[model samples]
Target chain A: MVARITFESVHAGQQLPRLDVPITASLIVAGAIATSDFSLVHHDKAHAQAAGTPDIFMNILTSNGLVQRFVHDWAGPGARIKGLKMRLGAPNFPGDAMQLSGTVTAKEVIGQDRIVEVAVSGKNRLGEHVTATVRLALP
Target chain B: MSGTEKNNWLEKVRAMVGREALPPQTAADPVNLPMIRRWCEAMGESDPKYLDGTAAPPAMLFVWTMGHFRAGPGREGGTLLGLDLVEAAGFTSVVATNVEEEYLRELRCGDVLTQRITLDAISEEKKTGLGVGHFVTYRYEFSDQKGEVVGRTLFRVLKFRPPAKTNETAARVDTDTAGVTQPLHPRPAITRDGAFFWEGLNQRKLLVRKCGSCGRLHHPPGPMCPDCNSLEWTTQQCSGRGRIHSFVVVHQPQIPGFQYPLPVALVDLEEGVRIVANLRDIAPGKVRINMPVEVEFVEVGKDFVIPAFRERQAG
Candidate 1:
């Protein structure tokens, strides 16, 4: 079981803990599969290279998932995601590492529910790969 | 290699259009909870909708249609959609370039699915960093038990001949491109002490080693026993009954002799010894901890039989 973070304990302008993901070929391949992005660019190296990329890279869906996980892992099982949107930039290829960082941007109270909006960014050596805003409801 | 040969090659390929790329096939396992659960767990999706196991994720359409390895044929060891014909003509390496899909109905547990793929289009010769090749596209349609279309996908691939290189840096395989009769399974490393174990597989039996001093049974047929330090040992025929202790679905480093997302398991035998082998007659999503299984000998290629495990029906 996972521990939960109460709405009262979270504050705007607070920084969440950082997570570094080692972008191995296996992780890239498995992450794409877990998200149901059954494209060759995310799994087959020869295919990716022929298509212009150097090797298999993380798919946008997997990036969205990695962000969702970053938020939930910080907010805990008690947290529920209300909305999530992202913009992808650099391609996260194998042999690179992604540093996922986030900050609480705002908080609100609606009836018995407390809604929190978090701004998240995942970066690699090339640059930022994904920038997103995650809105979650905390207990 | 000559002008007339080049023209005839494309003519042969052109005739395959609107034809079945490979023989019609069915999903190895029906849409079920275990596979759905595994995907959810890996993606960190804890939604009650999926946890309750009613509806499968819409994204699993292609995965559900992934085929199993069938010994012998035009496919690259039962994969690749008869692309050997393309490879034989000179385009040996392939890369998927694009895909578009549409979903018509939701897939649920107990729904068995089948697929039909047709070669839809082929492009003229193009030059690139990799080499000169053509862009081949196929249309895939998936149907359910009632023969209603559930989903469709347009898949495109760029098949090219690898760029030429000098001897000092060349690593390309010769484009012999025969009908892919290569062995489809990796051979077990037979050794002096482990010879009996493989020999048992030849005779369709499972063997465990018993320590002559204390009667302790062990797996892998080692020369010495860990429990009693006994140099003496003998063989015991096993019942081949077991339960899955642990397992994994391997997807990386794409070994040629096997399929991707291969399911391998550590099976705890009823005789109290554990052995590792591949799983058969089931999908990766169907494997579970403590589930009952039995040993099965499958001949994956010419005289290349390997020991694998299959689900044992509960009594």
Candidate 2:
């Protein structure tokens, strides 16, 4: 197992590892169902097409999840995300891939603890799918 | 619809704002390991913290009190504050536009969640590429078994009238998908409970879940052993030797990533457990029950591998 990333070990401008996420219909639909999003566009291809997409697209909750996973995967366990601010752009449709990459933008020391901020973005074939600023407290 | 009619309809629909979409609904099951495992699997998430600790993935905040769990089966579910009104107004299709959540507390196993949702707002009909429709938002307040507020999420959706069906418009529906290709294989839904199995596979070993208390081996790794219901368990490596118990050939609705007619089999391993895997190196029609097979680890994509079986060679 990789050592858990620590507050002392991280620095500004450090690029977290990249993750190439496969956007499958199963993933899109499973995330919708898992996140309790039952909206037709997140599952039904016909409705998604009618709603101005080529196929069933991902829900915001699922997109949020994939982003969090990206961070947790890099930061290792025991690191807790304080908050996430996200901006959605292109829809994450199935049969595409989202390349998730992040860079540490800033770090703060608060009363003996370290909080790190990362600027993360997911890009697909069309363009940026989702961009987020995630804050986490490292142990 | 006339201006007077639209005005009256909007007033009636807007008047219902702040009304409860449903009675305060409680989660059918408490926060649990199994559901968490399943979620991690679908996400293809491999973090071990979710499995080792009582804390669930924070991303699952909305799952506990989602529509289906609270409504129970055979119940009206996934209702927006003014969904019926919007649908009645000819905005029959819906798509979520955004979601914002504020987590106030950590969610742990055995926490029963109850939530109340009310219509927050419904915007005036606006023209969009999909068609003229309204943007609706809902406010959800969640509480745990102790009545302490745990989280809040705002869900925004566009309830729009679909564009008139045309050959080109129909063709555009799939425009987002026409040029795409399937990757090596769909990721396996491996959770922490089954992480050991996959990790073992990475080492070229076939491991089965063994109950530490009863000394019984079980396939399809689970948190609890069915025989002794023991929470304690270990793993034992198998020789990858098995026999086909039953098999099926899939030929329809071809999903990208695998060849068809694909042959999938349920094999009884010599270690006294049954496992399911894809069959390789043989024609689909040539497979039969009780045929001998051996496990072979095949890497379909970068860092992605699955245990498949091939026909056992003669002794």
Candidate 3:
């Protein structure tokens, strides 16, 4: 069962539960298409191979979207994402697995809103795939 | 890569910074009600200001200057030139990584916008999971017809060379021919300000919200009235009658659960505002500008239903 989280229930230094995600070719390409990103390497395996990559890889936009999903899933419906500063690392290729985890770094109150900061990371077999600092405002 | 070669390429790229990479280009259509209506429908934004034609949503900072899908305005020359130089330098693949926007002014209908793009920064060569490449950042400045800056955005992208696979054998690429289903109709992004529209649809009643103060009727319902800025409003049942003020046919990027060459219409409702919906029960070619269409609720999924339109003969 999915547990609901609230600002009152959250504290600094709390660890978020890990989420496992399966990377697939369709997910990589669909994310690229949905964002109107037409870079050949994102969808064309042949082009990717010729350019030197072993296969098509995920784009940063897809990674950003995944991070949003991860944070929202844990924060519950009332949480509002204010900002995300993320950096990509290892490539997420098809047939691989990505595990995401995060920790609450800080919580503050400002003008009737509770603001929380989360330091999140996603990793695969190759190592850390993405690292990010996400900020959210909750009532 | 040799040291001298790298230096030469770096110099060429460095020249792009601090210069207007994209020239100011005028918007094809000044901010208008029809386009705003379409944008709100697609984004599921029912903000009353956007519907009543008083002010446009601030989130639409980039929409004012975006050209058509394939044949619209070209990217700024300097930015394009810099990209060409980078591509020539062996970074052949590119993907946008991040966007940060700051809106300064509320754009309204009839406001003509122009944009200028400046190359902000270019990172040094970096090696990681996605081969080697440089990160390029461009700052877009959007201004009004009066040359007043209204908004700005920082867009960053990575251009890299694909890294060669070490041991994995080549695999077949996935394509639509693999019997990929059409995309399901996208769920509306509901918020507190616009929940009533969906509720009205559930009862099969076309509801238009009217301001308690000004009595102005607006579609894409929201809590506040744009005319009077009143928080009080009431819902009125519409005749479900409207005419196609504009239409478009989508053909490519087939999503699952939707027919290709989908016909979407922007109907000017009898209530005096406009709404957008799919034109059903008619072929794409038969849909004409200014044709009369009426509302029809479609059960797209088990718990999801949305209003679609059907053609009607002139009385």
Predicted model with the maximum TM-score: 2
Candidate 1 residue-wise lDDT, B1-315, digit = tens: 888887787878787888888766777678889877877665556655556776665546666666333433322224444467678888877655555555566578988888888989888788753468888988889999888888877777778886533211221112226622221243454667887887787788888888889999998788899998899988898999999999999987555457668999999999999999989878888889998999999766444457899999876
Q: All models: lDDT?
A: 0.74, 0.81, 0.74
User: Model 2 misses residue B61 by how many Å?
Assistant: 0.6
Compare candidates 1 and 2 on lDDT and give the better one.
Answer: 2
Tens-digit lDDT track of model 3 for B1-315: 788998798788898798887667877778888766655543334446667787765545566676444563453223354788788888877766666655566688999999888888889998744458999888889999889998877778788875443213223323356553222344565667667788788888888788988999987877789888999888788888889999999986554357768999999988898898888988998999989889998876444578899998776
Over B1-315, each residue of candidate 2 has an lDDT whose tens digit, in order, gives 988988887888799888887678888778988888877877766777677546888778878876663455633465556788888888887666666676777788899999889888889989764467998888888899989998887777788886654323333422225554433244564677999998888888899999999999998999999999999999999999989999999997565467889999999998899999999998998999999999999876544568999999635
List clash counts for every candidate, in order: 1, 0, 14
TM-score of 2: 0.61
Model 1 alpha-carbon miss at residue A47, Å: 14
The lDDT, on a scale of 0 to 1, for candidate 2 is: 0.81
The C-alpha stretches of model 1 lying farther than 4 A from their native spots are A1-22, A29-92, A97-139, B44-46, B69-82, B166-315
TM-score for candidate 3 (chain B):
0.50
Instruction: Please tell me how candidate 2 rates in CAPRI terms.
Output: incorrect
DockQ of 3: 0.04
